[model samples]
Target: MNRITLVRRGFVALALVSLVSLALVACGDDDDDDGDSNGGDHSTGSATIGDIAIEGAYARESVTDVAAVYMTIKNSGAADTLLSVSADVGSEAQLHEVVDSSMRQMEGGIPIPENGEVTLKTGGLHVMILGIEGGLKAD
Candidate 1:
């Protein structure tokens, strides 16, 4: 019934929502065919948007108002950039990277090389969700 407990519960709820969103976006067929015959070995938990493929998207638990999301992006065409990330559970979302063990917001976005891939994981690049609604309850 204290303020701190309520805040922690809100963070937990928000993290769960973010995780579900990532899972939904990354869910797809394992048949290497992302609606195309390219036969590029696209595995399970991968979804294609245009020439961009997203795989294994997930989020970490939150004890505060911020949460982090991780994933792998594969580019099958011209190079592209990841400008930003959004989640309904928070008021702000940003692309972040860790430098010298410190976290900072990424400027100019993340680049995906042509025919290459980028992995966003802990201690590296990831998405940060902030200002999560405090009304959320764990129950």
Candidate 2:
């Protein structure tokens, strides 16, 4: 298989593992709200990957099989492109753009200009998570 196909298969396997693990952990009361009961913070983190600084990463509580992740990607060095995104909880992850009230998948990836930042937010460019495992839980 080609590189893209291999990546997609990896994502599918990850999603399947996530689903099974989530199911195993879905037992017990889910009404606790101490912000730490879910074993990890659901909507907050920061990380620096090479010259790219990613911050404010979070996903809304998903009630369905789909969800989105919002964050700020800043490139401090040479220009780069966001080719693809993979997640452990989704079978497919895609970059999308919202235009004129319609959302569409982004092809060839999104460009990250040098010394610039891209904000992925609602009604804007964002990462769409397809086939989310057990949906996202609110924390």
Candidate 3:
């Protein structure tokens, strides 16, 4: 073959080989394993620590220096779920069941079910954190 023809053929071959390699690499990347499972992103992490799984967890306002942490403790086995909770930046943290009254109001700790959820919301029940510290976040 002529020198010019050989050079042109070599360049074309190199370009074609490069395009084929690129196509292979791109195909491998398009696999369905993008770390996003079928459920969702939030469903990836399990909420269980030891014997409790806290779900829908949130905190309350700080106007009265009191806050709450709510969660659904699900027991995977046939056993009683006795979970204890605490918080920093407070003198005393108590498990309180807030009862709404027309005239007088009351608060105290209550029992949580074995394999169910116990809500600590307004007008139902919540945790009364006494003597808050410097800063408190709802996180």
- Winning candidate number (TM-score): 2
lDDT of all predictions: 0.54, 0.56, 0.33
Q: Give the top-scoring candidate (lDDT).
A: 2
Residue runs of model 1 more than 4 Å from their true location after superposition:
1-18, 21-45, 134-139
lDDT at 106 for candidate 2?
A: 84
TM-scores for every predicted model: 0.65, 0.68, 0.47
| TM-score result, candidate 3 | 0.47
Show where candidate 3 strays beyond 4 Å.
1-46, 79-84, 100-110, 134-139
For model 3, how does the per-residue alpha-carbon lDDT over 1-139 read when each residue is reduced to its tens digit? 0010001111221111111111111111211211111211111112453444544443332333433333344544334423223444466555555334321122322444556655544345544455555423222
Per-model tally of clashing residue pairs: 0, 0, 2
RMSD of 3: 26.8
Q: lDDT (0-100) at residue 34 of candidate 2?
A: 15
The C-alpha local distance difference test score for the whole of candidate 1 amounts to 0.54
Residue pairs in clash, model 2: none
